[model samples]
Structures are given as structure tokens and as C-alpha cells.
Target: MTEQLPDTISRLYADPGEYVDSDHPAVEAFARAAVPSDASARDKARRLYTAVRDGIRYNPYVSMRSPESYRASSVLAAGNGYCVGKAALYAAACRVHGIPARVGFADVRNHLTTEKLRQSMGSDLFTWHGFTEVFVDGAWRKATPTFNDTLCAKLGVKPLDFDGHADALLHPFDGEGRAYMQYVNDHGSYHDVPAKFLMREMAREYANMQGEDLAGRDMEREATEQ
Candidate 1:
């Protein structure tokens, strides 16, 4: 059976929460412009995803958080943070617009770019970042708007775009088959993503564990010397 989103997700859109209804500015302006009664799910989902993607960035500073002070408009206002920040903005907008959305991640074997960069020194970097997953007509589609042009240019990649309907012409990675970031965990069944605020605690947990294991081996060697 296909996955179906809860009906409450729709209710939330009509009866927005404190943040969505308030004139806090961050989300107020964005919510007004983005949501349209006649727009299809794909149109709203794509616009929400792209709005965040084209607005925010993929910084390492912002904490892995659900929408707090930041919402759809936050990307337009503060305009910082990385994947996590972008994902939060995207999700908040989707929820506000009655589009059921969730966070996701992929273990990228290689982050390909139009050209190689100096910062990409080592091999197999696991930046288990955050993105948004929206339930369309039948299937759920993945989107990452956080890596906008500025960040992509710095990282030597292209900006992925998503117009209000179809995916925009700016998707960075090739998502068809080759450049796929593997999805092993079915939403924390095996892996964890911090965005969900549940089942998955953090996206970096697995990567952090690997580093600890290496440290343990080095410690053992030093103990032998002592």
C-alpha cells in the first residue's frame, strides 16, 4: 500500500499555529505569498522547497531544529544556515500550506561538482544533511533547496531549482540512478535524521560513531606503548 499523510496536516494549514498565524515577519510574509487555494500539491510543494532552496544556504552553524524563530520567511529574512536550516524553512512552509512534508537524508559516497574544490580534500565525506519529502499525488518526492547558488559556487556545484510546479532547472546532483545518495534507513528504522525530532535523533550520529571508533583504536595503541 502507498504511504498516506494524515488529514490533520491539512487542518493545520487552514488553522495555522501561533507562528503561522502571527505577524512575526519571518513566516508571515512568506506564508501570505506562497500558499494559494487553487495551487496543486506539486505546485505548492515545489514552490515551498524551492523557496527554501533559493533562499537559505547549507551552513554548518545552524542547529538541527524544527521551525522555532524561523519559518518560510526566515530564509528570506535572516538568510543563513545550511541544509538543516533550509530544511526547516521548507518543512514549515509545507505544513503551513497543508502539504504533508518530512525530513530525509542520504549517505553520499561522493559530492560531485562541476569542478573539484580545494576544501574537498579527503575521500567519502558523509555530510548526512537534511532535505524535505512531500507527499504528492501518489509517491513522495525528495527535494533539497538549501544548497543555493552561493553555497554551491563555494562548494563547486550548481544550484538545484524547483519552480512552483515541476522541479526547477537547478537540481545539483543527478538524482536518477548514478549520483543517488543511498537511502538505507526507512525513516530511522536503521538510520536517524535529526529533523524528525523523534525516531531519529541526529543525522551525524553515525558519522560521529565512526570517528569515535577510530579514536578508540588509536588509544589502544598508545596504551601498549605506555
Candidate 2:
């Protein structure tokens, strides 16, 4: 299929049907959260980000790799989730304000250390990890704020700000660290590395991340710790 804007945006903004504007109190509060009258696109994106990063902490009480029945209100009430829930909450909030945002993912190395596993476990690092992308200026930029201290400390990599226009700091590993190439709907064709579709594939493929947390998963944990 040829790349078309409306069709592409339609798929990109497809509702998860899990959360909506009035389903929960938290969602309502977030909807009411101030969107400054003078805000620009970046300001709007940042506001949505602050809501999740500061409002919620990262905890996997819900199905870690799968989304629960979290409406924006439920997430606000609970104030926590792994990645998907928080990202869903953020995306929902941004959408309500008429901002164009969608979920995205990457395999960040050294993401966390689990209690049952002290060593590098591959699949645990890539499960349903979600981030948001907002339309700005003439293009879309990425943002990741759901990852918090616990997960960052466990993985030993610095979590970054969701500016909606900066490169991801949670690199798999390099001098300054590098990013996992996005991998969704890949047909072994010429790829652009950051297409939004990769988020879907990333959520599905690495859902069972377990064991050695392969070099592909988080080589930094292995090289730095050992």
C-alpha cells in the first residue's frame, strides 16, 4: 500500500478502546489538567508527559506485557503501571487536547534487574514497552517518560525526558549509548529506522523477553556489570 496521510494517521491514532475521557476520575482530572492558553506544540507535549512521569510511578502490578482495563481515570487513581498503561494514559490525555500522538517502543539495554533473576535476562527488557510520539511543526517527534527510577536503576541506564523531539537516551550501549532500531511491520525492505509501526511489532515480538536478556536485549548490563 502506498503511504497516505489520512490512512496512516487513522491507523496510528486507532483507539485501544481501553481508556476514554469519562471512564474514570483520573482520566477526567487529566482532561481538566491545564493546557496553557499560550502553549505551543512542544508545551502541550511536555505537559502530557509531566502528567505521566510525575503523576505515575513504574510498577508492574498489572499484566506487565499486556494492557489492563485502564481508562485514563483508572490510571490516575492507581497512579502507576509498567510502560503500556502509562503510555496509554499519556496518549489518551494528549489526544483529548487535540494533540496528535501515538505509542512507540524500543529495546533499551540495562532496563531493569528482576528479583527472581539477578543476571541479564533478555525478554524481560522488551515487553510491551511504550512511548508517545506527538506531531510538531512539520513532522512527528518521539517522547518516553513512563520509565522511572526503579526500572532505570535496575537496568543501570539513565531514563530521558520526553521532549517529543530528542533522541532516546536509553541506548542498548555505546560510548554515549545508542538506540535500538525500531522494528515493526518490517518486510526486510528499505527501512527508515523510526517509523511508528515498529511499536506494534516491538510490543508483540519481544513480549516473552526472558533468560539471558540477549545482547540484543541489553548488552550494557552484561558488559558494565561483569
How large an RMSD does model 2 have? 8.0
Provide the TM-score for each candidate, comma-separated. 0.57, 0.60
Q: Across residues 1-226, which tens digit of lDDT does each residue of candidate 1 receive?
A: 3565567753433343332332345564675486575888777777666566665554443333434323334545666654545565666667666565555655444434322121222343434555666567755566767566655554444567665434332233544334523333333211112435421443334334322322122211222343
lDDT of each: 0.49, 0.51
lDDT by residue (1-226, candidate 2, tens digit) is 1233475564445333344333345564575574674687677777768767666776543433232423455566776665555666776666666665565654443333453333322344453356666665546666666666445554555655666556442444423454432333212211111223444454455444422233233323433454
Judged by lDDT against the true structure, how good is candidate 1? 0.49
Model 2 poorest 10 in a row by lDDT: 186-195
